[model samples]
Target: MSSRESILPTEADFADFRKQCLSSDNWANKYDKHGRQVWVEVHPGKKKNQVPKVHKIKCKMVIDDVPAATMYDVLHDSIFRKTWDSAMNESFDIAKLSNNADVGYYSWRCPPPIKNRDVVTLRSWQVKDDEYIIINFSVKHPKHPPNKLNVRAISLLTGYYIKPTGANSCVFIYLSQADPMGSLPKWVINKASQVLAPRVMSRVHSAGRSYSEWKQQNNPEYKPWLYPEQSKLPMMNPAELSIQKADELEQVDETFKVDAQECEDSS
Candidate 1:
């Protein structure tokens, strides 16, 4: 893989991906609950010994009484994430690549016997007319390599699209095309298709509800994403990053017996 600044996600890349997220032609509706709907587009891996299937998931919900800007802040507030993102094991900013983009490290828990997962991603954001978008895709960062504790996952494309409906409400959309680098069991796949999106959206909505108050008590005026001049993260050279491919990482077995209790708890 070429280690060049050009490898990072760009304005055109974000624009094209945003179009895909907004489009509905190829997406197959999968799950819907509590006003949230999820659609999945399954793409079989091109070659052998790669991930068998890559899932492009799109989920959306109308969040009432929450402004699009507030929901945007919720996604960027790492400190606030720690409190509500129970599945998260560890996360932090690695370096700033630009005013609208950065490289970061994130790891989260998987149900027992599935092992944990981690990723280094190049994240970017933009505010279009009536919309707020934040996106991230996996990247290999030299300073942070894969560890034995968590399987390195590949996030092909993942982000949020928030469009204001009114002053106090917005339509929240989450889109992701990711490969969890492991031998996924049939049951795991089934559970993911059925509940992952709704569960996550619920958590996000819950977080958004309380974020304004949380921000006030915390660093009320500190928003590095909106005002990059305030960021304390060291600037980074994009030449150090490359695409993180699933075949380059060690594959772990995510197939194990999970009881009803464990399944319920994970969701």
Candidate 2:
């Protein structure tokens, strides 16, 4: 822990995190469907010089009887995460950078012929004005290098914004921008943003509500502490995962930028 504690994230990290949190709130209010407040949008990210071959996923949801804290716990609880997030092949903390910061490893299972992708990230969170913010960006860790088993990806931007609206109710916005290394067909990215994001978010909301009960029954002793672990994630090839309609597939127009602020103009 001391070795991990020695290194620290810069002020730039916190600055970006705050900007994202505020942006989330702004977007949540900006995007509406038929006068409805909750909105979700998934689009192909602009091929910025910074991050190429990326997708931008965003969502807003209000869960009944679930507080912001509960949602945070359900997500950060590493042991519980394994049960819900279908894409997560393996996830565990690598080190404690500080009380509010850490290094974590996350691997996702990809449809075959395409190797699974993983990343090592420095994560941090904060609670202010009853709004919770979680942010993580990829980093290079000495002990955790690119493994032979998985393609290493870079998480350019990944975060969650949870703001309380009422008792036991909160607004959630999730955003992700990542480059999953290897040649992932544009159709795969398109379908992921168009199809999978909504479906996965629905699962998250359901799981967030059921998590506490599931925890009590299963891993009651589970400590959500930030301790390090080297997980050897078994690669289980599920049958249903595949890219459909290769002939009809088309690439996202990389020249077009999908800015959140500009999303209101999207039909």
Tell me, by TM-score, which candidate is best. 1
User: Among these predicted structures, which one has the highest lDDT?
Assistant: 1
Question: Model 1, 1-267: lDDT tens per residue?
Answer: 264347667778778877977898767788777889998865444454453455677889988888999999999999999999988888999999988999999888877777788888999999978779888889999989999998887887888899999999999999887766677654455456456668878888999999999999998999999899999999988877888888788878765575422332111
Off by over 4 Å in 2: 1-18, 21-53, 185-191, 217-267
Per-model TM against the reference: 0.89, 0.67
lDDT on C-alpha atoms for all candidate structures: 0.80, 0.58
Give me the runs in candidate 1 sitting further than 4 Å from their true place. Answer: 1-5, 42-52, 190-193, 258-267
Per-residue lDDT tens digits for candidate 2, residues 94-189, read: 756555666778888765445667777777777667777787666666567777777666665677888877788888777666555455554455
TM-score (C-alpha) between model 1 and the true structure: 0.89
Residue range with the least summed lDDT across 10 consecutive positions in model 1 = 258-267
Residue pairs that clash (backbone atoms under 3 angstroms), model 1: none
